[model samples]
Target: MKTVFITGSSRGLGLEFTKQYLEKGYLVIASCRTPEKAKALHDLKMQYSDTLSLIQLDVTKEKERDRAFDEINEVFDSIDILINNAGIISGDGKNLYNLGDVHKEDFMKVLEINSLAPLLMSEKFLPLLEKVTNAKIINMTSQNGSITQRTQGGKYSYCTSKAALNMITKILSNDLREKEITVLAIQPGWIQTDMGGVNAPLKPAEPISKIIELVETKEIADTGKFLTQEGKELPW
Candidate 1:
């Protein structure tokens, strides 16, 4: 069976991805910082049993990342696809004045978790990933990352981190091309997750199912693109 490693699988979009992939017969390595707190994943584990395996991971922690690499090394041959599904939003970034009032520490924390850690994970696991014939690294990015669209302009931390993630995606795409791993960024649309909020247009299921389809059909030429659910490439 094909294997996938997904970060932030404790809840929201991550949980959904774990559920869907397990149903499709892929062995899923689901990682979250707090495994006991992941009630949904806990329930799914009881039902899915053998396919879904939980591991402790907090991207901000290097020790955790190394431990995860060791775990994956022991559990499977190599990951066919890796979904960097972990992300965070500034609870303070709702309006303009809110940006000024935001704590610098919180902003740095978000960047560490959202932007830098994924790069670290990619670098650390690159060797193991090299074993897969069709290796893929999917960075979960946002339309907010689009330099072309500014909109109302409040979420400074979230927006800048995702934009940086896009740049990292491009850099890795170029770097990994010769290595045979496909590095790509995807905009999962405004799905109704904890971060996306209730008013968000589509449900998590909609964008996620579409993303899986895209991953299955992902082409060599599709690298470095900021793509949307409908298969249209969004502007970087």
Candidate 2:
């Protein structure tokens, strides 16, 4: 079975990805900040004991990331897919991330988790990815990141971070093209997650299912593109 590593597998889209992939018989290495507190992941672990491995990872901290990498490297030969799913939206309760309300500290915090962490994870796991054929790095970005698609602005930090992630995805694709590793920035439309809110038209399951299919089928030719859940290319 192909092995996939997913960050932020404790809940939301990340948890759904873990569930679906495990159901599809893929060996899943799921990481989150607090695995012990991740009741859902632990429950899934009970069912998928042989196939699932949970690791504690903060994603932002280098020491934790290094430890997680070493732990995985010790057992697994390579990882076929890396899903950069960990992200955050920093809000100071009063501010709505509007122009005047956007604080540097909040903006930087969001950037560190949503943008920088993914790049760091990809770099740290490059060796494991390189060992496999058709390896992929899937960055979970947002349509809010699209410069051409932007009509209104409110989520300054989240939007900026995802936009930066899109650029990182493109650059990484170019750099790793010769290595034949596919990289993509995927926008998983509004869904009923904590981030997306309950009023969202779609649910996590359907979008995540489509995303899994996209990951399995997309080729090197599709690298560096910003795509919707259906695998259609989106504007940069």
Candidate 3:
């Protein structure tokens, strides 16, 4: 079975990805800030004991990232896919409202997780990815990242972070093209997750399912592109 590693697998889109991938028979290495507290992941672990492995990871910390890498390397020689799914909208006790309400520290914090962490995770796990053929790095970005798509302006922190992530995806794709590793920035659209809110037109399952299909069939030529859940290219 192909192996996949997912960050922030405790909840939201990450949790949904874990569930679907495990059901599809992939060996999943799921990481979160606290695996023990991840009731949903633990429940899945019970059902997919042999196929699932949960590790503790705070994506912002380099040492934790290193540790997770070493731990996974011990059991698996290579990973076929890496999903950079961890992200945040606001920092601890910091507001990310309109211009006057936004905090600089909060902006940096959002960028750190949504933008920097993915790049760091990709770099940290490059060795394992290199060992496999057609390896992929899937960064969970947002349509809000698209310069052409943005008409409103309140979500400064979240929007800017995802935009930075799009750039990282493009740069990584170019750098790793010779290595044959495809990198993509995918927009999940408005779904009924905590971040997406309750009135979203779609649910997590549908979009995530389409995303998995896109991931499974994407080609090297599709690398560096910003894409919707259906795999249509979006303007950066």
Candidate 4:
């Protein structure tokens, strides 16, 4: 079975990805900030004990990232897929998403978690990724990241963080091109999640299923593209 590593696997899209990937018979190393508190993930672990491995990983912490890397690497020789799904919407843990409303510290926190952490995780896990054939890195970005897609802007930090992530995705793609590793930034759409709000029309399952399909079928040609949940390319 192919081995995959996913960050932020406690709830929302991360949890859903863990469930589906386990069901599909993949060996999944799922990490969250608090594995003990992740009851749903625990339940899934019980159900798919053979295929799922749950670990504690606060992506922003370098020590935890390195520890998780060592632990995971000891068990699995190579990682076929790495899903950098961990991110934050608000810095102060509020709905203060607008430019004027959000504080500078909050904005920096968002950037650290959403933009910097992915790169850090990738850097730490490069050896394992390089060990695998046709390895892929999926950065969960947003359509709001697109410079051209912005019409009515308000989410300064969120938008900017994702935009930075998009750039990182491109850079990684170019750097890893010779290694034949595919790197992509994917917008999973506005779904009915905690960050997406309750009014979101799309649910977690729909977009996640589509995202998995895109991940499964992605090729070298698709690398460095900003793609929708349905695998359609979006403008940067």
Query: What TM-score, computed on C-alpha atoms, does each candidate reach?
Result: 0.95, 0.98, 0.98, 0.98
lDDT by residue (tens digit), candidate 4, 158-236: 9999999999999999999888889999999998888888999899988998999889999787788899999889999
> How does residue 214 of candidate 1 score in lDDT?
92
- In candidate 2, what residue range of length 10 has the lowest lDDT sum? 88-97
Whichever of 3 and 4 has more lDDT, that candidate is 3
Model 3 CA lDDT for position 3: 98
lDDT of 2: 0.94
Q: After superposition, how far is residue 160 of candidate 3 from its true place, in Å?
A: 0.4
Model 3 clash pairs? none
Error of 3 at 106 (Å): 0.7
- Order of candidate numbers by lDDT, starting with the best: 2, 3, 4, 1
> Each prediction's Cα lDDT score?
0.86, 0.94, 0.93, 0.92
At residue 106, candidate 1 shows an lDDT of: 74
lDDT of 1 by residue, 179-201 (tens): 77888898898888888889998
Q: Which sections of candidate 2 miss by over 4 Å?
A: 91-96
**After superposition on all CA atoms, what RMSD does each candidate show versus the true structure?**
1.8, 1.1, 1.0, 0.9
Runs in model 4 lying further than 4 Å from the true structure? none
lDDT of 1 at 159: 86
Clashing pairs in 2: none
Clashes of each: 0, 0, 0, 0
